[model samples]
Target: MARWEIKNVRIAGVAAAVPRNVVYTTDFDFFTLEEAEVFNNTVGIKQRHIAPEDVCASDLCFAAAEQLLADLKWERESVDVLIFESVTGDYKTPPTSCLLQDRLGFSEDCFSMDIPMGCCGCMYAITTGGNLLSSGNAKRALLLVGDTALRMGSMKDKSRVPLFGDCGTAMALEYNPTASDIVVDFHTYGKGYEALMTPHGGFRRPITKESFEYEDFGNGIVRAPLHTLINGMNVFSFAISKPPRSIETFMADYRIDRERDVDYFLIHQANKMIVDRIVKKLKLPLEKVPYNLEEFGNLGGASIPSLMVTRLRKQLMTEEKSLLMSSFGLGLTWGTMWLRTQPMVVSELVIL
Candidate 1:
């Protein structure tokens, strides 16, 4: 149980970017119209925005960062720290954050690095950037998170293809002495790493000609070894068990009332069924938990913030409110955080 209470860090603004290329679950040839309807209703994913072949996660994040910097009117050189979180980078070498720093025209002195994470990427990046500001090491920081997970799924695979979308998000965090503290908790079950992973393409299992060969995993699911492999049952069981308990414990330990203290629960939009299960188990009001999966599918680490920008932009930009967020998936990682916002500038969703 890793927990921290970082103070004096405030979120200044947020922005999200998605590719204009739209893909509908109904268009997938793996399922008939009737099956697609049932799948859409069950997964809550009607369509997704996928990046074009030339657009990488870095490209999307760069676009979002540029927009957010302009919206906040912050000098590019003033951003002292940059953190790019994603499972997919533009290359296997030379951290993507460095590339983004150059492209975004941030000062050469800016501390930039990359964190490779899946669904929990946004929270992890926030935690890292918040601590930097809280410790006086940085006055302002840009936490950019996103993923091109859709490109990793096999078109022939019914289980994983329709559930992913490509997106990037930028969150501005600045040090504010009077700001309320942000509380966070994290847990990892390393044994389940294989439950949701790409079996090849990394050093441990270097990609070979055979890696591209597709094989059937059963129930009409087939994918190449280089593509993502998800043990759906194991992931579902882990999600329902870990995240709820983590949230319950964090709230109790911090004396947080889900009904009163938190205005909304921004959970990682993994899928409709997973969100429904967690909401029911936690006994939270459905109205309080918003969803953008129907429009954007799963944005990996960018899901929560993207949801904040797209679905709760009005509230976030108009009123002061407390938000509780949870993200769990890939790497068997899970985390929860509680923070308060004060009418920050949340930009309109940008489509590339």
Candidate 2:
């Protein structure tokens, strides 16, 4: 079973950062005004934060991490672990987490690693970090997740471009015996891998001159071999089918009562249709489901955490809350995380 409870892993705080530049749906050059309106209403993505040419996912995470560490009033060396999750890394060679560890000035002995899972990243990284602290090997851990997803899409591809935005998030966890346990369950469907992926740039399919040529794939999706391509129908069918079953399994397996046990449910911001469908299928209250995907496009793994910083910021900062977080998308992986958060520091939304 890919389901278990991690004990005594307390959520200490969270912080997030997004690019300063804004691209309103109507202003997106790829979409005509009428098409843009349809996209905004249908997908519920009103604006996107496009990162500048020089900035990378690591840079965004660094800014968020730096601010969070300060707000939490923790010294650099006191941190014991750092987990970074992103697909758009600094390089394909050196893991970006290594660069962040040095850049963040953590202790030389701090455990650091990289997680490149796509949309399920936040929970996966958090669960990994939480397990590390729960094992008594570490006292405090940092989980950083983000994606410059816009960088992966072809600008001219209407389906790809408007559906992505850039964001980085930092979550701090601590070992506290009395704190509530963080329950997490993850499931993977490797068979659906090609449903959303870049077919080149990896060792198996090294990039060549032809990798740069964008091909019109019959629909609005046009992309190079090096760029990520999503089979929308495949992804949509999987999204609508798998996640609902997964959520039901969690609720049954874990004895979760949505009305009684949870304060909020933050599912992946894949789009408004997917979100609304899952919510309706699960019978989750729309009021209790907090979604801010419209403010920033589908942020891959960072979507849920981004919500904690933006939509539910004041409430979370002022009071204790229990949240059910799930993200299902790219990589064909998804996870459900139940977090009991105390009144914690949530940094102001950073515009980098």
Candidate 3:
């Protein structure tokens, strides 16, 4: 029998990247709360980080990866595999993970690949990488996910244009059977793809000037152009419904109590309302969920990792806490993972 129940890989380290450019809610003229009732009704978003126009999603991933590797004292050559999950990529051809491997000066022996998913990519990456390491094929792994999707639109689309901010996050995972407390499950609904996605630039819809025509999903709500049609209602419904189911599924399988066991619920940061609805539906206490949206907005794949980094900085997470983390979003993808926090040593130079 396996010495472990396949449930004992601790989180080694985590780091995240946000662009240097900070844009406050007041930066937009017509979109400002003072100017538009809709903006005011939706609530002020505070501030968000915008990547330099020249930077791409892979660049942000590299930045965060550098920080994470340094923080964990992981030598580039020691990384056996690199799993990069992202909805946005530098381009459709070369895998972003491979590009990052070269950018970060890693040995060619490293296994580099990319898993293309939207909001759920972070959880999926963690679950996948953890399993890979547990198999003992790879001892150490770097999981990086980020997006520069903010640049996906022109100045005309106000809804998604400002709400998204660029960010990248990396998690370092190491195999350790002695600790023995990791659980993960990743799922997807391909049918939900049309509900929230950048419908262009892929093989299906080649990028063209005419692809920029915007479409309204009823109720005078105009979202991105035809190339990118995101149905907020459908997306919201799925997000709210799926996360609780996922959590219930995990708890049932592991025979763990939800209320008594989970100390924190590190959910993906798609938006405030989405999170509120899920938390309510799950019947989880408000204090259990961490909030980074109020200050950073939604960083997509980078949400959970960034939130972890913030919580770690505040000493809010400790070895005693049992965390139930879930991520949901575009691609209609979602997943949940459970793990017991454990002490992991690191160099002081990591988070700078």
Candidate 4:
């Protein structure tokens, strides 16, 4: 029930970058062709862009930020704030945002930090960036969200391997006194944290030799503690229930009429099943929710903005529209935000 509104901030542009390597679920040796097809029909993911071994989330996000900044023609020095949101940072120590700040050549006076989150990271980052602009503490902010989630799971794990893709996105927000307020709502269910998480590598359970030892997790799914672990049924159950309720609450709290006031619902590309379920639960028109899972799979926090650039760039660039975005995943966290977008520059997807 954490809900609030921030004003005087407008999204100026958005861009996304994905790896060039393409992986088809059917090509996975772990699953038979028939099984792959069944997974495709049930999970709704056909292919994914996998980052090369040397690539990290920051590399993809840097590409996106570079492209967006160039399209906006905004001086690097003018960016007053930068926020990097992801569970896959370049290192475990120094914040990834600091690395990006140096790479992007932003002024020393700029404020930069990192937010470690999964599917909901983009929404959280936007809310944080908007607040900074609203408080007049930043004139322009860069919200970068990306993840190399594909690298976190076992290639043989059917429960997670085929559902994740690699991507990074950049969203530029600027202080605009004439802009309308951005309304956002956030909720968390800590009890479900184990539903989706990597069991080791954190402070509580530091990585050890045993962490890398693979074990059969049944149903042909095998993974080590270091690899991502997903309780499929629990995650699916959470997805089907939380997002729809969160969206309804967001709309009701903001007094928004889906048919008349909202232009689109850019939901997290978790899977086709989850997206369809939420849409049906909320009784939303099919056309109002856009999806890119067929081509990109799930990009974690990058899914929303990346979906916007890939599927709705024309609408975003040619018309003024009201957009409601929702994301749910790791931390058992979920959030919704409502914002208005003016005709703005949206760059083509950058392939790294």
Which pairs clash (backbone N, Cα, C closer than 3 Å) in model 4?
none
**In model 1, what is the error at residue 8, expressed in angstroms?**
1.1
Which sequence of candidate numbers ranks them by lDDT, best first? 1, 4, 2, 3
Q: With candidate 1 superimposed using the best TM-score fit, by how many Å does residue 231's alpha carbon deviate from the native?
A: 0.6
Estimate every model's Cα lDDT from 0 to 1.
0.92, 0.89, 0.73, 0.92
- Give me the displacement of residue 72 in model 2, in angstroms: 0.4
User: Across residues 183-292, which tens digit of lDDT does each residue of candidate 1 receive?
Assistant: 99999999999999999998999999999999987888989999887899999999999999999999998899988999999999999999999999999988899999
lDDT string for model 2 (304-336, tens) is 889999999899999989899888976688888
After TM-score superposition, the amount by which residue 61's alpha carbon in candidate 3 deviates from its true location, in angstroms, is 1.8
List, residue by residue over 93-137, the lDDT tens digit for candidate 4: 899999999999999998999998899999899888998889777
RMSD of each: 0.9, 1.0, 3.5, 0.9
TM for every model, in the order presented, reads 0.98, 0.98, 0.88, 0.98
TM-score of 2: 0.98
Candidate 1 at 195: error in angstroms? 0.8
lDDT-best of 2 and 3 = 2
Worst 10 residues of 1 by lDDT: 150-159
- Model 1 residue pairs with clashes: none
Candidate 3's C-alpha lDDT?
0.73
